[model samples]
Target chain A: MDLSDVRRHHLSVVLEHLVCSGPRSRAAIAQETGLTKATVSTLITDLLDRGLVQELDTPTAGRVGRPATDVGAAGHSVGALGLEIDVDEVAACVVDLTGTVRTVHRHTAGNRDVTARTVIHRLRDATQRAMADAAHMGIDCIGATLALPGLVDPNEPTLFVAPNLHWFDADLRSLATQLRLPEHFPITMDNEANLGALAELRHGAGQQFDSFVFVSAAGGLGAGIVLDGRLLRGAHGFAGELGHVVVDPSGKPCACGARGCLETLLHSDVNPDELARHLADALRTVVHLIDPEAVVLGGSLAAFGDEFALAVADHLHADTLGARWHPCAVRRSTLGADAALVGAATAALDRIISDPTIVPTRALAH
Target chain B: MDLSDVRRHHLSVVLEHLVCSGPRSRAAIAQETGLTKATVSTLITDLLDRGLVQELDTPTAGRVGRPATDVGAAGHSVGALGLEIDVDEVAACVVDLTGTVRTVHRHTAGNRDVTARTVIHRLRDATQRAMADAAHMGIDCIGATLALPGLVDPNEPTLFVAPNLHWFDADLRSLATQLRLPEHFPITMDNEANLGALAELRHGAGQQFDSFVFVSAAGGLGAGIVLDGRLLRGAHGFAGELGHVVVDPSGKPCACGARGCLETLLHSDVNPDELARHLADALRTVVHLIDPEAVVLGGSLAAFGDEFALAVADHLHADTLGARWHPCAVRRSTLGADAALVGAATAALDRIISDPTIVPTRALAH
Candidate 1:
């Protein structure tokens, strides 16, 4: 403790209560959080002025004197900008405090045909347009996150490599600067799969499974592992590289120069049964290693329907070591193609949701 | 939180400071933890009364005025018991607060030839003797943990399944009663691989790499995964079943009714070159999924010397997708065969280290 730490802690407690328990009276928040009523009222006032929370019209009408007004997280006052640069398309979206996507912009482009710089500029332009829309709607953009289809530098705004994107060691900071984001607005970059996993955790399959492995296969095969309600971005942020795992040692060479990797089996002419077998084989390894509760298939694979998921699940069940006792479910992604963009936006908003004190109050707002 | 929560939090901070930073003066601890000198003095007094910490004779000789006494974690005053039930033997040991093994007893026997009840009794006898040893040394055993070579019920003292031990749904609570441990002396059960990973984390390879996978092949092939300095026990505590992961899908049938598991390639007559290839294949999948920083070979497999490890490492490096950027090392276990036992004891002691307030004061001690 410092004074600011205590203030932020109290503010977060009140904000999280409304976010998790729906609207609640200030007195109820005090009782639930074990804070004094006076303290709760002061914290609620701070949150209300910051545009992070709003007073609801509903009152404690049942057998109560001078009805207490309910408070809740503000819906449209603030939002986060999420940008994605995929292999074939550029997308941008703004997500509000309640995890609702308010605006979306998608542009199909020959991303691989153009230089990495050109794709970056295109994504930047999309982000600029999204910001304009957010400002026009009076949605205070608290932060922004760019979802890239590659290995992101855990320490810097850089992309280590995106084999499918034909890019290596790309600078993301320059792009952030080009967007001319508000100073100290906290723009960052993350891997697409990781962000997609975050999106699923906040808005989709997360309701059913707290721990899962999100597998996406639109432009490339990748995985995002969530365990105990948090994303598992391993020792160098390269934890879920499911595509490169060698499924067949004597099989065809992959784009990453590996022989018989999981990606090699996803050829257009490949049979579903063969792909299912290979996918099950690789997923079995993942289940054995991390032991997630469910396997959520996203990207183009979710469109394969229930039968495909069943086949993969069948193989997984047959060979899983403790399948009889430890059951693992396999299902399709609820968000489908929108998972990555939504996840990117969710990641941006989480910066504020996790620390409400970071938001400037109305008096300080420019 | 309540008053007790605040008290425990402060106590934990003071105890952890001594454990992690060595001996420190009261003023130094208060400065480090940001607690007032009066509060630190009260917490330290409480810890002293509970036999968790001791004041050292060393004084601030170079400082002005009266010399300030140093306080540090008490090594011999308190300890935890660790019991192990392996395929061929029963082992028990006591580990003091400093993580040093004080007493160890290993009884080698043909455990497979006996009934589950008979083996349980045998382990009970070993635990009884270890408790006597601990008592003779005037060490208060705060807790006890049993390590088994199978799935441990995370919520109970039950052993879900120990395939090699020929045990299923073993009633560990009954065994706990038979040992007649002190009242409120917490006793728990955990998987051998999980404990081994914990041991490696606190005392062995954990010093070098915060995250690594401990692969052991003595009784059977098992892996204990540690990521970001914590064990990655998947949903249902069934993670790290490396032995059962299918390696040669078209090869021989495994004992688990699965065809071509990693364990099948580890037969006595199997060629090292072929075995290394299969192990590497399975490990490549593990690497892609969890991305641990190192792979630690333990038990019988570690005795294969540097050549076998190097062969496996070479194959793993050659095929791992992000090998060029994210490097993973392969090494032998530092604690060797004793990892599980030490880890079990450490896990037992962690119960107190994490919450020192739980330990009754000396005046309330039995």
Candidate 2:
């Protein structure tokens, strides 16, 4: 739907929420949203007319006299494309509103110029393949969203910095245009950590949390901070640059030229697999600063599993803060490689239903 | 107005915004808030009926058709009270909605027990005097809010820890009750730094920026963080304890029993006036980590003026981040000792105007 079709988009959002959260009566939806019951009933009726929602016969107890019908989103009204851009590989998937992956595609990075043009070319081919696979399964794809590891400007379709990809100043908007996608089809992009956090917030460990920081540890360390039920993109869209924050002054010199950045010490290259003991010792200082609910360890390194996460958590516990032993649980990302892709799909769905204007059509050309 | 009177509160809020922002046409308010023009018109009419807002008679050109009526809040409806509790003193003030302080009261402290009880006693006496003065000037007092330098449970009316006061687990709600406050009146308490940041967000340097950290340096250090237009209270209301975050592993011992906490290193005792040069060197590390919009210097130390703040800022600039130098501006708090007090008053006023249920009445006193 386009920006002009806000009413339809609003209905789609209610339908999507109902689908994600299971069936609920119009009264329940109105209660949760503070929307008028009449307005909700009208919206649900519109959704039913569009074949986006189905009313079930079941009635919830608590209503005195009248039986309320529960309505849920249709599972196959539309589909979303999720793209994940890594340093050496790209992964794409088609996911339904309920977060079920319908199709998947993976590609490797060649010795291409890691510029906007080159990445867009790879994305276009991958998207085509995924769409074809989905089509074979009778699934209709709607739009796409890309998730990458680096700084991203939400206002502009572009990468601020993707150090591992050796890309900088890449215009994602123009790249998507070159791919020749549908005119009004929307595309969205955000940092991998942010996407990971979004995924967790919607479908995993962070779902119940109002504030938490998701740390992605791979080629570089990045954080996705969710505060008060919203992602915190700082004043300059650089809020979650937790990796660049100085952790130790006398330690290793980072590429960012700062001494002992969280990434410089925590990354696999700096500590190595054999130096896990030393890594635990180094991490003690960081945990004391930001006392997050849970320090979620994601990315390729998290594949090592619970042992590594526990060792780091153990060392952090030994460090005393004001005679009170400060402890934060450390856990690995469950989605692993697909986390960012899932996050991207969620972002795309959110855009389609909440703010159609946010997604740049040019970014989805491929 | 009670919580049941939501429409009245909402209209009052619009009128309050108009009053704070000066005269604005209904069309302008509707555009600024994304509220429907019809809704704005209806609300404006209701506000005019209540005598909370008045329509301007002067007509201005520039509109396509008929000029809209300008509306603004009646400036003399209510006054707010702010109370600040420090280690050695208790300060109180009565301020108008426009942030004009009509009167202030200051009291000294001798010991923890005596101080806590005496502060509340003095606060009520001072508030009564201030109300008398306002009554003579024809302004009505609404409610009071207290700002304390410690961990506070907003859900519970108590001070968790007032280190300088040497009070722990003090029942502040009981004190408020003993003072015999008006029924259903709002009396709120919050962390000093959070309120300081709130004050800045609503009326100071932070108004233009959505996210930044406000560090209050006094006998100890505390931070007020604003992220995405909301305060980040963390999972537990103790999010902005930047002072207690361990910075040095083997540095001088802090009162909190940690070595080299930001507070221990930056506080007045650790950095005596004679050792300003040495303290400036230690302060550089903090400035690098959180490259905020501006490092606001508040508390008693701010009275020393630009020289002290500049010395700390000078050291921060010397420490480069990569090839780029950190350039967060340093400014002293304009509110002085009254900052936390003003912040508390604002918080109280916010609670009174938003949710009457949250405001503990003597009837519901523990």
Candidate 3:
């Protein structure tokens, strides 16, 4: 690699260490990253100049030599904007670089049976309101990510299809153009299920489990799978699609045009016992194929509480092949229904942390 | 990284390039790896001395400068031993470093309901005969991998359970001790389905597809999933347990203690049409979850031919959610029944390719 590329890489490595591992001394960063103390100090200085990191007042107390200064991700100076378009709502959230949510603007609108242009306008308004709130709180929006409830085109900002929203091949470029988002703003799109899984990985069950599936059952049945700490998007960015898995071949037709999908079997009319059974059948497919460490019930599913979680766990325990040995835990999502929004925000912040060079060198205006 | 670690890493990189990408001149290797020509030459010289790579007589002809000599993986100088223990047979195969099978010994025995010790004894005899054949062919075994029809403890040479073989927690370390395998011979254990998938990835349908599932239906139903060229082993080694996925949650009890499993529904008594539907249910689960490029059906199931494959594909097309946009192909296995054996041997060969330093420096005996 060239000198500039190498410098950018080192800068990202140092910044990521502080973001992921929390506050630590330069000596510890050098020891962990295997870079020389001089290189780390230089990178930290660059990050500080960019207002991405700040040195803390607390110093090493038990050191034999000079006490090293602890550095951490700067709060409120830099932030990310997360936008979401679900079947029944359009929401926006702004989170600081430290992953603290500063503002959330959720508008409960019947987004279904509507055109993509209408939904995008509503989302744009919500985003503007959320950005205003973030600016009021001293947070600077650096990048943005939009999470939609459907198959998202991984290469571009396009929502290929959302059965629940009755939206197909929606052109999301207008959202960026209408908002006048910067040319290099790092605006991206992702499936809400994938974003939810990412949020769980970053701030919830992911802290304890490296591999798990986050099932979102808000207005639709979907799943976000994490394997070894990475989201599994599959060959066509359509993975973790639990809603489409066929539960019965001769059963009812699904919204995706498939017959007898797991989504078809799951309905509000079904009693708790039957609901747990249907969920177990879908979770059974995940447990069989991925054998993840746990399955986090997120979105509206967590609202069912412990009784429902235990019922689903019982079914999983009884049906899974290696339940006698490797038991897949069924847990409730700590982030509840906001996982996808949080995940979207986290993904946006990751852009800056991944390449701190994007952040201009400037001090925080006091 | 330390100096030794860096050197070892570069050596492995050069060797892996030759093994995976075929023979290339020193200049090409240097250009591809971004290492200096001098460093590539130095690493190549070490590899040549170790008999892991051989210098080819054909040189680069169209280059502007001097014609650089081509280097390739050695053919018979080093080899690996692959052993397998199934419910009905014990087999062993030997393959040279270039992934060429040199010898194979198969013994058909009803290993079901038999003790793990008895099966291990038979496997040992088959391995010894194969090793003798390999020795006759001027191949020296550097490592070995044993593939079992059960869950393998990823951290050790232990078979946690093989329901078909009725073996639970079988101690495979004893087999290594009985063979008097070297302390660092790199002996390991893996699930046969996983081995089959790896083999397919290296030599079969994996050539055309980056992500696919290898379904093994010889005596029991199992699946080996490859996503983006990497095997998905889940949180535990028990991933790809497709047989136990409940098809009829209350249908019939399976050997795995799960009622209404897909395996329970799949029997000789079931007709081809019914069989295709059952198979499609499982494949649908896979496609919905992974959305792979294709699904390669292997083991005894491949014997059913194109008619069965087409029927299964029909069901998948009718049942899959996004079949129009992202259609998943259904294909028969090209390697047939030998995929697991080849995968086992290839994995053993991977040990040397992954760390060329493991092969001691020595010229070819000839």
Evaluate residue B236 in candidate 1 and report its C-alpha lDDT on the 0 to 100 scale.
78
Model 3 clash tally? Answer: 0
lDDT of 3 by residue, B153-242 (tens): 666777888888888877777677676665566788788889899888877877678899999986778899998877887777889988
Candidate 2 chain B worst ten-residue window by lDDT: B356-365
Q: Candidate 2: where are CA atoms >4 Å away?
A: A1-13, A24-41, A54-70, A110-113, A136-140, A268-292, A307-329, A355-366, B1-13, B25-31, B34-41, B54-70, B111-115, B268-295, B300-330, B352-366
DockQ of each: 0.63, 0.25, 0.61
* RMSD of each predicted structure: 3.3, 6.5, 3.2
Query: Chain A of model 2, TM-score against the native?
Result: 0.78
TM-score of chain A of each: 0.90, 0.78, 0.91
Task: Summing lDDT over every window of 10 consecutive residues in candidate 3 chain B, give the lowest-scoring window.
Answer: B177-186
Residues A1-366, model 1: lDDT tens digits: 545666787788778767645788998998999998989999988998899989989945787477888888888699899989898899989988877788998988878856877887788778888989999999988888888888886568878888788888777776666766766668888889988888888778765687999998868889989998788888878789899876776788887766778887886467778788889888887887778899999988888898999999998888776777777899888998999999988888877767997888887554
Candidate 1 vs candidate 2: which has greater lDDT? Answer: 1
User: Which 10-residue span in candidate 1 chain B carries the lowest summed lDDT?
Assistant: B1-10
Model 3, span A1-366: residue lDDT tens: 334666887888888778777889899999999998988888888899998999999845986888878999899599999989898899999988777888899999999989888888888888889888888888889888898888886777677788888888887775777665656666888889999998888788776898999998877788998998788988888888898776665678777776677788776377878878878877887898898999999877788898999999998888577787888999999998789998999888888977898889876565
Which CAPRI category fits model 2? acceptable
Which candidate should be chosen as best, given DockQ against the real structure? 1
* Chain B TM-score list for all models: 0.89, 0.79, 0.90
